[model samples]
Target: MASAARPQGFTDDIVQRRVHRQRDQFLQCITKEKVLAIASSRRPGLSCDYFKDPERGSYNLCCFVAFEDGQRWVIRIPLAPCLAWGARSKLEREIATMQFIADKATIPLPKVYAYQLGDGLDPLSSFVILEYVDGRPLSATEVDSLSVDERARLYELLADVYIQLRRHIPFHRLFDDLEGLRPSEIQARYGQRGVLSSATEYTTMLLNLSDNALSNTRSRILDQEQGDDVLYHHHLFRRFVKEDWLDKRLDDGPFVRVHGDLQPFNCMVDERMEITSVLDWEWSRVVPVQYFQPPLWFTGHSTEFLALGYPYLRYLERLDEFLRIMRELEVQKYGDDLLSQEWEHQKSSGGFLVANALENWTDIDRFSTRHINRVWFRGTKDAPKRIETFIREDPTRRDLVERLCRAHEIYKKELQQLDGTSDPGDSATTPDPFPRRPFFGTWESSVPGIITTTLALGSLIIAITFGVWKKRNL
Candidate 1:
């Protein structure tokens, strides 16, 4: 969902961004000629006008370029370097997923007019031209302003989008991302990953990725604090999930699709308050059910509003209302409504507490053992000595790399459609998979940022829950 009301600051921000784009930094990255080519090549012999002001979201630099006489398209250039955490394979995945949804579901997503994938380090040439959507974002102010029935009707439309995705998109494999990659790439990386064998696998892989990310410093954008707290929180969250606290009933996987950043800005709606197009598929992925939470709209929160006090209570009430309506519709169509069930189970298990803390960079420290507990060996004077001891004697830590390598082999093999004749993991028995990487590598890692950088920890939590066992109680 959007916001209570797009403050006047929104307009000012756009103007400021336009001015910022004119600066040398962004000009060096975006070339008018290249933007023109992307637009012109898609539709030749049209009166094309390159719009000078491009919209810069954290994920991409979007510009409206040369257009057909009757229609318009948007060229989105990802803001991250191709080498960034989510940037590597994101475009290919986004393009593939958008196309798949367009073909299979009634969900209104932008059609890909044309696209160019990024090279290993290039951001300029990587662009996707999508049919320009003409709609406003559904804002909390708008939803709250509505009568109860009006809001319900809007939620109905939103629910259908989720329903269609669940009904049509096959669970081919558990994907942390849903954007498309070449089958060749898929085959090479994970063997055709043609199976959604279990939920445990999905969560583990996500946790592994998250673990590696947190251990790296370059990703420590959220916390400039040079402390052990981030790692401690990582340890605590891992411990909590693995203990009997997680929603066990729903932990069994057939990973479900999530519009990773289903914030209001991406959810475009017509005047009638319906989902016209969901922008930005780059972050879309098949998250494990345990990690799943209600879309941000229902939560009435954003990066702008990060607390869980009143907003969270309001979220509960709104969620119940929305799900009740969605459940009725879902049952009528499919006779089963696992989505609603998963949401309830997840909330009851308090998984979102970890999610909110981990996802919000500023809040991560609050969950650390030091803040929550001072008597344990972890929080006591023996803490430093204990960490070293745990690092050396912790069986799970010693074999984490090997375990990940094996899991990757399973992923690669399953995707490749190959017989499992050989599977050899990493040769080194290093405690850290990405020991040299910065940010998240500290104790647990690095800290949080926006929607994209959590993969390392994302995988870490999943692993704790499903893939790796807690050998010793911390």
Candidate 2:
């Protein structure tokens, strides 16, 4: 069967072109002889053909260099924009993570042959050469197509990998150690420190992506409605940050080394359905153990798809089986029930709730308050009461609540308009209620200038206030 055509607005043409241009420039910097020399240590007299991977990644471009003898290697070039945005150190961190896992864990990963940062011959290029594993990414359709026995076998393989990953002890500090790499040098290269220890620190780091840094630097031509959307998200996030109850819960666990990006596409499997390799460890970090849950792709539904109609419910049987398998594995390894512990902790801490909230903030429909309350506050009736105190005490909290209410009203009106329904409440059942919008076309037209100006002013005020507070505290 042929792959379905990607929906409009789903393509990353600009990023793709940038990646291809960088690939071409890096290829130009070296001759066939130079390429042969780089691989000569592993494969003598290695003449090769190079082709870029058709499936493009967000930050790196992968190219296959196949030798005449049928041996293949993968060269991953960090895209120029990514490097400029401090991804060189991220790449280095990934290399360090792979090396550490190779030494400490039983999980299979690509063997890194060589890595290079900009030098005299190619001052702007950075790439990693690794042994190529011949396997395809396991898709949701592929998972559904598998036999029951085959799916079980695949789950076992994945479970073994997960167990090993979790069993490996976390580093005392959050940062991975790359030999001969200085902390200052790493910070200089990345424009920020690499390490994180506490949950507050980790949450702050993730929040920074939505903060003034990206908002101010992002192209002004982006959709105006996006500003209001962002403000709405910030309002939700501020609750998590300001409420001591939420912050303490967020900060309530021991750090564990986690494969932060473990979506299905990152895992490779051969015809036998055994995991051949796991790719992309750039975002791996020492985070709280509460984050070390099952892969989000197990349900075979994206968050966007979930917002449409809770489509993941169609895979409920499979999800149940997957959870059973995980629970059995966890019991065998740790002599405790995984799901029960996770559920108990989630109820008390709302860790997963807050995480899902953060991850799906941009798509509020997917992370609605009703869903969060059902999942995280199932047995507790004091949910509103818990936040009630914060709303009463903090003027900022009250302001955010008002902003959130106003934003939701606007969102409902937009949904009603799209659905062609007079009653906004009826919009939920409207077919294809929220068609995907282009990234640059996400801003609202009415209040773009006002939102931008307000954000800038607010950011400046916060910066000044922080400076004064720090000085006085010191």
lDDT of each: 0.51, 0.50
Per-model TM against the reference: 0.64, 0.62
Error of 1 at 52 (Å): 7.3
For residues 251-335, could you state the per-residue lDDT of candidate 2 as single tens digits? 6455566665666666788888889988777656565555555554556676545433345454445545765776788788788
Alpha-carbon deviation at 330 in model 2, angstroms: 2.7
Q: Could you tell me how far off, in angstroms, the CA of residue 226 lies in candidate 2 after the best superposition? A: 7.8
lDDT digits (tens) for residues 140-177 of candidate 1: 55677887777888888888877776667645446343
Deviating ranges (above 4 Å) for candidate 2: 1-37, 50-56, 68-70, 85-88, 119-125, 172-197, 213-230, 240-252, 307-317, 338-340, 343-353, 356-474
True-vs-predicted CA distance for residue 424, candidate 1, Å: 48
Q: Tell me the number of clashing residue pairs for each predicted model.
A: 50, 6
Q: Model 1 Cα displacement at 237 (Å)?
A: 1.6
In TM-score terms, candidate 2 sits at 0.62
Error of 2 at 136 (Å): 1.4
